[model samples]
Target: MTTVQEQPVSTGGTPSVVLHAAEGLHDLIDGHGDENDRTGRIAEPVVEALYDIGAIGVFTPRELGGAEMTPRQAMDLFRTLSYADPSTGWVTMAMGLATGLAGAFFGENAARELFATPRLGIAGQGTRPGRAVPVPGGHRISGEWSFASGIKHCTHLHTAALDAETGQTRFFIVPVEQVTFIENWDVLGLRGTGSIDYTLEDCFVPIEYSYPSLSTEPVTGGDLYRIGIGNFASINHGGWVLGVGRRVLDELAAVVRAKAGRPGAQTDTVAFAEHFADAEVRLRAAKALLYEVWEEIEATLARGAEIPLRLHTLNRVALHNATFSVAGIAQFAYTSAGTDALRRGTMQRLFRDVHGGTQHVSSSPLVMQSAGRELAGLEEGKRWVHFSLK
Candidate 1:
């Protein structure tokens, strides 16, 4: 594992400032857990706090007025933020990852405009369901994007669409103003994410703001567009799951300690002490697995090599480890806390958040199956499965 630099309280950089500002926001959000579920407005405060603390630009390339931290550094940041609050960690990780992708894959002009601000939020949808038709100077894009986390606070969106002219899939940079947030993120967990629907109505996007999925051509005007999409996406999602898993483990430990003496307090005979110990072992194992995979990702980036198929498998494994850890921690905490955990409190909220975090497609069973099939030498049945950072 890489020895991450001790992040200063304030690095005097935008990323550092984000971390500094978010220092107390986690507690504030946790304090408002009830409203977070009812109004989906917790993300707004979280974004503001992140900006106040300088936590948003770790992945922003130096050329884009931000730090050029490695994937490992980004993961370290995520782990820290997640321990504070998983929702904040999730939104920050998703936006940061999107920013990194934009810096690495979008055109130079697009990169400059997108990252021009000290703190920018970008949201993305993996499924390319939008339509893009070439026109005189740009493309006419129109579609509805769903599950766009942080959409309420996003300044830009990275959307995928199929081009009508060449039938090739492409990604477009759309200003948040061009899309209308539909307030549709109703779910059991991560409700604070404000992951609503976005409607793009006949939006005209410039040609320079888009890139074909397989293009290796350099962006004409910016240095931020040097990173590849596949590799960036994998790393971003990896950090997100890692942060959430770590947070879940922390919550579980706290709950166990609090309830360890409930039934046999004076006797020190906690009924499920062994179970809690086993769960801790599993959580540690999951953390180790995720860190190993992240190290592989960092090594690949350092070598300037494309993310290989094996690395994708490893990324999937890391995500699997995160989900498994969340499930394990929740199970251990719930079992140890008994019915008390389900009451209206921090434990209940944490339980819901962890389960919600796992529902993301990045951490879904489909990802595991894809990795497994690749390992077994099965023919890639879907174009999405055929995708690799390399």
Candidate 2:
């Protein structure tokens, strides 16, 4: 188990503090992988270690006492953690994004109330809109949501709901106590995420606690929030794919090196070497493309301009390429590792995690198709609203 730091981590303009913490926790996180997989949730010590390092709020607004890490910094942070353990990286991503959104969208009163605590972790799903009925002071939300990643360790929940009368999807922040857990998170990969089902039974959420789903206008914070949640999510997903891909390749290399001296080893052949080189190029190229796209987006945001359709289109394409490219690389690693990958270990777990991550809506075939349509100038006058070109 990892030892949680007694002191709070500093976010004093030094992203290295967070990244170093992530790198240092590799052994501890990897050590708990089996336990996390078996229990369908991350171990408490690992979770505490992450919180102690202030990783749970990597993307939250800096003014609200979060790291508010830049795209490059956030990418490094996520990549480091993911390389240590995919599930740990995944849970951190979910919580960080959720907490950042809460700080960005909520009103002053809600923001103060939410960020009042020293440690704040938020987890919930927004893909499926729930029903929200308006009342005098607030809305009554009632619906079942799936894939609430990291919910078991969260202090608050951020869910999306549709107001039938207005046809508007609104995001609401509710205390974890207000929601009911269904606890059906059994899955092949990312089991440590504990992304189980949950329900809100006519939960009364105040007007101050909710924000319009498609609004890019933030109640607080600067450039980061301006990119909107969709783009933000893409950045995180891209980082995670890069990290997981790197780890898979590294592990495969170790296996190949160990087998190199064996008599008549198949992995030592020229053909195998060429194939491995190609895999390296593919993963490296994918990562470069992702970083390039983010750099462009960051520049646009810094200039106080809305991210153009072209950039949004490219962002989605970058995520798609990164994800599928990593998936291919992982496949190559597994096939190359042969029977060794069949045993229950890092290679096996990563194979499942990569496949499971591919199922996410961010990198779905439909989303890629949408990006293609935009790139081909077929979606004129349309803009991205979440994963779709609206």
- Please, what is the TM-score per model? 0.83, 0.95
Model 1 misplaced stretches (Cα beyond 4 Å): 1-29, 32-34, 43-45, 117-119, 214-234, 263-271, 378-390
* Candidate achieving the largest lDDT: 2
lDDT of 2 by residue, 1-390 (tens): 111122222332346777887889999998998788788899999999998888987877766667778887898888988888888889999899888877878776667777875567899998999999999899999999999999999989989999978989998989999999998987888888899999999999999988987767777666777787888767788899899999999999999999988988779889989989999999999989989999998999888788899999999899899999999999989998988888888899998899889999999999989999999999999999889999
Against the hidden true structure, what lDDT does model 2 obtain?
0.86
By summed lDDT, which 10 consecutive residues of candidate 2 come out lowest?
1-10
C-alpha root-mean-square deviation, each candidate: 5.5, 4.5
Candidate 1 lDDT, 271-313, residue by residue in tens:
4666657766876776678778768766765676755666667
Model 2 lDDT at residue 304: 77
